[model samples]
Target: MYAVIKTGGKQYRVIAGQKLKIEQIAADIGQQITLNEVLAVGSGEGLVVGTPLVSGASVVAKVVSQGRHDKVRIFKMRRRKHYQKRQGHRQNYTEIQVETVNA
Candidate 1:
């Protein structure tokens, strides 16, 4: 089975034993985290979507690692002004292993 869950202001599709990177979370490696905002659940039969979220449904996962994403370059320039600005940013992220989805 698979589940749609919300965390760190984002939604992710996860299945048992799956690993995924998401926006940063305040947890250490190997820590257990339960995704409470389960949006939907799916099986070989079909899928069940919720109105906002499914009640009494959740997904459990373990923190695998924490790190930053590759740097993104931002450049800006003005025509004929001989002015330019350049910047780079790396977003933080967390890697989690989906343990199970309970619906």
Candidate 2:
């Protein structure tokens, strides 16, 4: 079975035993977290979509690691004014292993 879940303003399609990196969550490594915002669940036969979220449905996951992604460079310049700016950012993320989708 597979599930569609929302986290950090993004949606992800996931299945049991899948590992995915998502926006940072305040949980320690090795901790188990339940992703309660399940939008849909699907099996071999059909799919069930929720209005917002499916009641009594959840995806259980284990926090595998927490880290930042590669830096993203930003640069801006104005031709006449000779104004320039540069910046770099690394977005934090959490890696989790999906354990089960209970629906």
Candidate 3:
């Protein structure tokens, strides 16, 4: 089965044994996290979607790692005024492996 869950202001579609990177959460490596804000759950036949969240449904995952993503460079320039600016940023993220989706 698969589930759509919300975390860190984002939604992710995950299945058991799948590994994915998501916005950083306050959890250490190897920690077990239960994501209770399940938006929808689906199997072979049909899908159950929530109005805001699915009651009593959750996706359990294990935190594998915490790290930052590759730096993103931003630049801005104005030809006539000779104004130029450049900046770089790396966003923090967490790697987690989906363990189960309980609906």
Candidate 4:
């Protein structure tokens, strides 16, 4: 089975036993996290979509680690104006292992 969940202003399709790197959440390593914003669930028979989210359904996960992603360089320049800017950023993320999808 698989599930579509929403978190951190993003949506992700995940299945059990899968390790996912998502936006950082307030949890420690090995913590059990329940994702209640289940947009849809699949059991090999099409899919069950929810209006916003499925009622009484949830996806369980275990926090594996917390870290940051690779740095992304942002460069902006304007020709003949001698205007240029360079920046870099790394977004925080959480590594979670999907344990189950309860529906």
Candidate 5:
């Protein structure tokens, strides 16, 4: 079965044994986390969607790692005004492996 979950202001479709990177969460490697904001659950053509959230549904996952994404560079300049700006950023993320989707 698979589930659609919400975390860190984002939504993701996940299935058991699948690994994905999400916004950094407060957990250590090997720690199990239960995501309760399940929006939908399904297997093949049978799908159940929630009214905002699915009651009593959850997704279990294990934290595998914590890391940052590649840097994104930003630059800005104004002609004749001699103004310029440059910036770069790397977003932090948590890698987790889905263990189960309970609906």
Candidate 6:
């Protein structure tokens, strides 16, 4: 089965054995975490969507790693003003593997 869950102010569609990187969470490597904010659960053509969150529905995941994404460079310049600015940023993320979707 697959599930739609919310975390870190984002929503993700996930399935068992799938690995994805999400906003950094306070979890250790190899730790199992249950995501209780399940929005929907589905298999084949049968789908159950919750009003806000599915009661008792959850997604189980194992933390694989924590890391940062590639740096994003930002540059701004004003023509005829001789003004320029440059900046870069990297976003932290946590990698997790979906283990199960319980509904």
Error of 5 at 62 (Å): 0.2
Q: Per-residue alpha-carbon lDDT of model 1 for 1-103, expressed as tens digits? A: 9999988888888899999999998999999998899999999889989999999999989999999999999999998999999999999999999998999
Order of quality (lDDT): 5, 2, 6, 4, 3, 1
Provide backbone clash counts, one per model.
0, 0, 0, 0, 0, 0
Candidate 4 structure quality by residue, lDDT tens digits, 1-102: 899999999999999999999999999999999999999999898798999899999999999999999999999999999999999999999999999999
Q: Model 3, 1-103: lDDT tens per residue? A: 9999998899888999999999999998999999999999999888999998989999999999999999999999999998999999999999999999999
TM-score (C-alpha, index-matched) for candidate 1: 0.94
Predictions in order: lDDT: 0.93, 0.97, 0.95, 0.96, 0.98, 0.97
Worst 10 residues of 3 by lDDT: 6-15
Question: How would you encode candidate 2's per-residue C-alpha lDDT over 2-89 as one tens digit per residue?
Answer: 9999999999999999999999999999999999999999998889999989888999999999999999999999999989999999
Pairs with backbone N, CA or C atoms under 3 Å apart (clashes), candidate 5: none
Q: What are the TM-scores, per candidate, against the unseen true structure? A: 0.94, 0.97, 0.97, 0.97, 0.97, 0.97
Candidate 5 Cα deviation (angstroms), residue 41: 0.4
Model 2 worst lDDT run, 10 consecutive residues:
45-54
Stretches > 4 Å off in candidate 3: none
Better of 1 and 5 by TM-score: 5
Give me the displacement of residue 92 in model 2, in angstroms.
Answer: 0.5
Best by lDDT: 5
Model 5 lDDT per residue over 1-103, tens place: 9999999999999999999999999999999999999999999999999999999999999999999999999999999999999999999999999999999
